[model samples]
Target chain A: MNVKIDGKYYSGNKGETLLELARRNEIEIPSLCYKEGFEGLGRCRLCLVEVIEGNSTKTVSSCVYPIRDGIEVLTNTKNIVNMRKDIIFLLLLRTPNNGYIRKLAEEYGVKAPSRYLDMEREEDCILCGLCVKACEKLGTNAISLVNRGITKKVSTPYDDASKDCIGCGACAEVCPTNAISLVEQDGKRIIWNKTFDLISCTRCGKCYSTEEVLHHIDEQLGVKTQEYLCESCSRRLVGEKFKEAFQNLI
Target chain B: MAKGIVISPDKCTGCRICELACSFIKNDSFNPKDSAIAVLPYDSVGLQVPMTCLQCDDPHCMTVCTVGAITKDPKTGVVKVDDEKCIGCKMCVSACPFGNMTYSSRHEGVVKCDLCDGEPQCVKLCPSDAIEYKELDGPLNKRKNIANLFSDVFGEVAE
Candidate 1:
């Protein structure tokens, strides 16, 4: 499909959203709730754009909005910029410590805190839903939005150690606020409420897989292997087997 | 996900982070008075229980809204007020069974937990994991884990 973004006509792929098309054309639209891999949530209204379809024009979230032919999208208009500025300001009030939100606020020249600042809650989740979505997509369901209203937060089941968690680290990888982290300490891999015994590579002696993670994987896929080995070592064994077979054939 | 936050009252230590987080997002301040969630600390016994909306299956506040302002979100199962339709009647405030709803003097309207659009902040920042957000089918995860432990150790729940 062909869409006109900022007066520049560009051909977009069939499945690409407006945000993808705009970013591919070097148009950077700020968004907090949209991730490259997941479905567009459209929670954060920062990526609002005025789209003109001949007779009618409406402002929509560029992240979830589809890019189609004859759609003229205005990304950085005066109104859009002001709306983005307002969202950044409110986001700063909620999650001031988040680096991504802070940098966006700085770039938009939001120097002073909003009068909503007589008091504040110090948290870094940003309510972005990236981590929660990532965790759910990983099929662990370990972390979710817990409680209601401002008490809402990302946490494990019953706020206790997650028995279903596989320690995949996908949630941490996609988190924009850096609120979650996977750390190895004392031969154990820990994230949230679950801890696993780190398994060292057979050849390189480097810790790679956690015991709980491997067990969870086995439970999910019915794998019965007992030996603990890293990715490279397993690859090396396969490669060595291939080499031996080739030599015998020769 | 239509989920609810389950609190393990025994684990609470009165840090009040849930209260701070609640008020900050709701009123843009950390004052617990404005928070929808509260940490009720038993001063004599030194016990704290964080309380908020239960997302009841049949909410009294929703039924009592004369102007039809209070409505339940089908997606998240959270009961919310339609501000434009709300006449600030405070009828739902009195109808709430748990008293989680409140009348805000500054805003001149009744306020309650809307589940923060399904991303509650209090559950996110609870240090002791006293609060948990999950679906209704399998809410008490910790209790289930304990039951499993007991089965493992004692070999049966009952004869």
Candidate 2:
């Protein structure tokens, strides 16, 4: 199906979202919560676009809006620009110190927030829930967005060290504002208030994974390896076997 | 039914040719670490066990996937992961019981044996005929008979 975006017709496949098609065609659509390969949440309204019908235009979040034949979309109209500015202004107020949010606010021409009444509420998290979504998708479900309204924030159950968390760092990797803190120090990984011992390759002496994650892999997969070599070292070990096998030919 | 790779650990010489072939064909590199099939060696017993995905009738990876990215095709019986739909969450990596699911750091996604599109490279390259791709009905039936016999022996003892 062909859909018009910014007056240009772009062909898209069935079940393709407007934002996905736009992104495939190299049209920039800024979105905070919508990630590729995951279902679109439409929580962050940054990718809102105006869909034009007969004598009427309806604003929709393009990330979750599926495209149909002959649908015309205007991405950066005056109304959408104003609405995006408002969203960015609100984000700026919530995450006053986040560099990513500040950059978005600056791009949308939102100046420094004048209201200083809630300085104590200043935080770095935008509460976009990307980290929570990533954790759930990984089947761990270790972290979630807890609380309600203004108090809502992502945390482990009871804000304690999660027993289910394997210290894989998927949540930290998916956080848009880098709010999830996962630090490595002294051969241990600290995340969600839990410290996990890092496992180093027996051959290369490079820390590759954590002990808890390896144990989790063992429990689920039911296959155990004798050695603790990293991927590169293991590959090299396999190469040595190949060398020994074809020694006569070489 | 679909053909699957079967390994005979006794026949394996531990040369690691199957790993080289699989990794080179699938990843365009000669890295055994990236191979879908793994050859584990036990020096004490002098045994080499080649492990790969069984593509089970009810795959745990498919059931635990939150985004419905992993699916087993009914016609081909090939369990596959859709790269376009996968979120690099590693859910399937932990769900597999046989340690067959692999998460590639280079590609940033989980990958597993797709039977090499029905011609398993490891089966072809195995020098000792340790790995074979064929219908598993005979082996499965024989294993079921042995299991029944063991259950009979243990059931009487328990009673």
Candidate 3:
């Protein structure tokens, strides 16, 4: 199907979303919550588009808007640009120190905060849900949104050690604002303030995976975890064992 | 892309984006109230579960439909509600064991998942693969009980 985006016609598939279509045509629309090959959600209003169908026109999220034939979509209009600026201004209030939000705001010439809108500087978590979603997608729902409204923050249950947390570090990897901190302390890795004990390789004595991570893996794969060796050591041992078995059989 | 949706409660993060996507796709607006899917959040236990139409082989909704408005697809085995034929009696809604069926205030009729004609919006929009659309190899069914009411909003977790 052909979708008219910014007065230019772009070819898209039957099930393509406006975000996917615009991105294919090299159209620039800033989105924080969208990731490649993963589904887009109701969060992140950055990819708004003015969808015009003849006499009717309304702004809709391009990230979730299903692309159809003969619909006119404007990526950036004067009114849309102004609206986006306000949204950026609000986001700046939430994650003031974040460079990603600031960099986008800078593109819109939103360099600094106005005197009347001064707020205290804070951490970078914008509550985009990418980290939480990434964790869920990785088969571990360790971290989630805790509390409500302004007090809403990413944390484990009771703000204590999480039993479901496997310490895969997928949450830290996908955080848009670089807010999630995964730190190693006393052989236990702390992710989102949840501590998980790390398992070490027997030969090299190098910590490879968390104990919970190994257990979770074992549960998923329906196999008993025989050894707790790092990837390389395990492979080396397997190779040696195979050679020894062959020699004995020969 | 085999049969129907599969819910893994452990993988759910209670984002409710699945609900948002379902509502928007159905109504062209974002409202969880109009959504076919609902995420029951057990915050005390830090557990989130996505609940929706399980599309059972012998569906209670289909059986209890007084007007015979609900029918199952022969090919995909998806149970669907035909609104044009529906009398709005809400028999199917009450008879539904999973409580997956709901009354849509916007549509003035009962609403349930049609699997989006085989490409479910909930599965497509779920950031976590908690809700998935695949071939059903076994009899994985959902039966609602009194326990669901407490577990959906808030339930205690043993420390």
Candidate 4:
């Protein structure tokens, strides 16, 4: 199928979305909550683009909309710029201190929108659905969207402890505004701390947060009497022990 | 007709997303050890070089494979391993120039990039457009352009 994006005719595959086609053609479109190889959640509305010749010519999410034949797509029009600026402004008013979000807003020259109502909560949850997708798709249901619209949150049910949480920290990793954090507690357990550090292993170069090491024996290795090592280290240690054991047995 | 992956160093921000995506797509988890793509970071220089299967025309890995498991895809020009025919040899792993090919612990066979069937997920997910899918000749020009753009943006590359 042929699609005209910014007056350039391109061949698009059947059932391919407009966003995917645009990306394949090297068209730049800003997206926050869209992750490739996963289900599309059009919550952020950051990837809004104008379909110039199609019936849906208004600002529509390119990520979710499939590419139709002969459709004219304008990715960086003045209206899209204005809408993105306004959306960023409103998001900034809700979340003021996020460095990532603030930087994105600054890139678009957006200031905080005026407060519409007094409806503000202690916690900031823009409901981007990254946490939910990370849980459901990744086979670790550590979080989910609770409550109905206007009250929905990417949270655990009843704010209780998650039984199936593998603590992969994918939820916190994907959060755009740093709303979720996996916290390490006194080398015993992990909890949601709202502050996170994307720590990497010094030895093997694996990515893990500080909270992931919370219940790990390595967390108490230095302080405690018994030394705890990671899987690779422990394997070497175990090999040495087995060698000694075999000699003793002989 | 061998296909190779070209990485633009100037565009790379050392995010290691390519490594993660490679591992996830191949291994079904986020373990970099299983990933065929390797990102080597030089902290002193603040630079990262992502190395992977080049699928060279005169492929060393295919020549070294004793059981003749490694073969080049005619259509995509990507080197792929016939896992069913593989004998779990380490010759191909040793023959790799970039040290990107590896023996999969799960499969007990050598694994490398198949370019994700020519629709590489890493190229799609890269935030800075650092990684791009193009013909072998096209990627070099693209990298040169990106380096010029980077030099213009950052003033000068650090020595």
Candidate 5:
């Protein structure tokens, strides 16, 4: 099969995906969720490439779509930028807290969708299949997709305690939105911290605890303080936390 | 003896070359999603912050790994994931404060910055020169001391 990528023609196998062909020729294509050895989920949409031939042009996920004979692939184009931006914008809407996705969105000026989709924005699972692939490829099978269609989620079988989980923490690491947190507490391995913390410092006049005050002061001044008072109050409050040191200083 | 990558956010431009170079060198492909180092952007603020494993002296990832798949490289001070030993538990991923660790869909193992064997591709490819690869002890401490002094004198305004 003949494929023209960015005006450069190359001979490729008939069944090969555009990503596979491009990698074989050392041509760079940006992707996030697509891995070489795993099945393509085409969820991240980071590897969308434009194919143009004759008067027809369309954007396709290069990871799943196979390269056809005499097809021309454009890796970078204005239309591609727009499409990618829209896809990324949708992703951002779902997982707005992710710093990595936010960076990509900013790079392309991805605007927030005008109409809200009523989708749950609680977590940032781009559903890229990293967790699922990690389980299947790594032989752990600790995580897999549960449900079908819009209700699908990467989860353990039957939501039961996974017997195959070796506690590698691979699923939590690959999550773009930090939707899953794998934690070890009291000898039990569990996924937690899925909810975003809405806490903000109240900026109360005395919000910092005694220990916090000392720690912050020590960090800032490069000197250890045994007292709990703010810099101004420390001179007066030194009697409680620092008896010997305050006496000596006095 | 373990070397680490130090990123100064003030100098970062969010070019994402670090992500591309890292994924390319480690995985032999150009994909930011596979890269160990992830660059997070605050679009409204026009700020880009590159995050990766600090390979901390007391690493939370290592402490949290139950099967001990994640280990510290004594020579370069990088935390490495042994694919064969990893059970895909995702514990270390949650333990990391900076969110630097990434799970590989292809490898079924959690991946983090290994400093590229002391020749970091991220530092080489970063257009804004936001990242610096250096030894942890002398240069890093010296730089931190300087930053501390500046921050101390200027208060929070130094940031």
Candidate 6:
């Protein structure tokens, strides 16, 4: 189906979201909470696009808005820009110290929300829930956005170390603002207020990953004989075998 | 011939100059954590292996990417992450069994070796000559040469 975006006709497949089509066409639409291959949460509201429907116009979160035949979508009109700016301003207020949020605010020409509101929140988390989504994808469901409204935040169940969390660091890796703190030092990996002993490679004696991660892989994917070896040690074994084979051949 | 970086583990000194060079060239920083190539030191075996993306014919990272952000170019055989489409999901990081794929917090994306755009910094800066950027078939040809010697000695048994 052909969808008109920013006055350009772009062909989009059925069930494709407007944001996906826009991005595929190299059209910029600022979005924070939308993750590819996951259901659109529409929580950020930063990807609002103006949809023109004959006599009426409506603003919809383009990340969730599916493309239709001959649908006219305006990505960056004056109204849409202003709305994006306002959204950025609100995000700035919520995450005053976050670098990503501040960068977005600067790019959109949004002033500091502290000046007008006279109130500043010290929290750096924008509650985008990308981390939560990432954790859920691991099938652990370790963390989630808890509470409601202004008090809502991403946390493990009961604010305790979740046994289900394998300490994969997927949540921290996906966090836009780097809100979730995951620390690794002294052969210990810490995340969500939980500490895990780093597993050492049997061949190399180098600490590589957590014990839980290996156990989870053993249970879920079945165990391999060289599972305990680090990437390089196992790879080096291949080189050694090649050397041995070459010597025999010669 | 398709080019690649081949490592001789015996020659590697575990100096990690490859990691530094790669991180500096790619990310303009000196952090090994952000480097595309990693040197894994095996202290027990007195061996070090410089590991990077293998540019597999069938990549696990590309398969696990939910958003289709990761693709392998058939012409170059380089697997790459499209930054615009990547949502920083880090699924590729977990999916790679060899731990070659890295999730860089600074870049906020999963990054792997692209052979430094056909001029590998790691191979250039490797002082020991353990890491070499050459034709992928170079080692295979050596093996084939030795195999031919066997054929010559056996005089091709009648099949």
Kept native contacts, as fractions per model, are 0.00, 0.12, 0.00, 0.00, 0.11, 0.14
Give the C-alpha miss distance for residue A204 in model 4, angstroms.
13
Candidate 6 residue lDDT tens string, A1-250: 9998988899999999999898788999989888766778898999999998788999999999999897899988999999988888888877777888888888888887346643455677888898888777667789999999778999998899998988878788777788888899999989998999988888888877887766555454343334566655544554444344434543
lDDT of prediction 4: 0.63
- DockQ of all models, two decimals each: 0.01, 0.09, 0.01, 0.03, 0.08, 0.16
DockQ of 6: 0.16
CA-based DockQ, model 4: 0.03
Per-residue lDDT of candidate 2, residues B57-127 (tens digit): 77877866666778898867889988756755565664454457778878666768899788999999899
Task: Give lDDT per model, in order.
Answer: 0.70, 0.77, 0.71, 0.63, 0.64, 0.76
Best TM-score among the predictions, by candidate number: 6
TM-score of chain B of each: 0.82, 0.86, 0.83, 0.80, 0.81, 0.83
Rank list by lDDT: 2, 6, 3, 1, 5, 4
Residue A119, model 3: Cα distance from true site in angstroms? 6.6
TM-score of chain A of 5: 0.64
C-alpha positional error of residue A46 in candidate 6 after TM-score superposition, expressed in Å: 0.7
Off by over 4 Å in 3: A114-120, A238-250, B1-159
Rank by TM-score, descending?
6, 2, 3, 1, 4, 5
lDDT of 4 by residue, A1-250 (tens): 9998888999999988888888778889988777654555888898999886645576789989888888898888899999999888777776666677779889999875456423353445577887677556544466788889667777676776666564545566556676876565533325442333434434454433343333221222222213323323322333333233333333
- Scoring the B chain of model 2 against the true B chain gives a TM-score of 0.86
Per-residue C-alpha lDDT of model 5 across residues A1-250, encoded as one tens digit per residue? 9999999999999788999899889888767786555556787888899988789988899999988898999998988877787788777887776777778878777767547533445666778877777656545566887889888887777776665554445567655556677655433445522211121222223322223222322343344433222211321122122222222333
lDDT of 4 at A173: 55
Task: Give the least accurate 10-residue stretch of model 4 chain A, judged by summed lDDT.
Answer: A216-225
**Candidate 5: misplaced stretches above 4 Å?**
A11-14, A24-28, A53-56, A113-120, A185-188, A192-250, B1-159
* Sliding window of 10 residues with minimal summed lDDT for model 2 chain A: A241-250
Once fitted onto the true fold, the runs of candidate 2 whose alpha carbons sit more than 4 angstroms away are A116-122, A215-222, B1-159
Which stretches of candidate 6 lie above 4 Å from their native place? A113-120, A225-227, A247-250, B1-159
State each candidate's chain A TM-score. 0.83, 0.90, 0.86, 0.73, 0.64, 0.94
Q: Which has the higher lDDT value, candidate number 3 or candidate number 6?
A: 6
Candidate 4 RMSD computed on C-alpha atoms after optimal superposition onto the true structure: 17.0
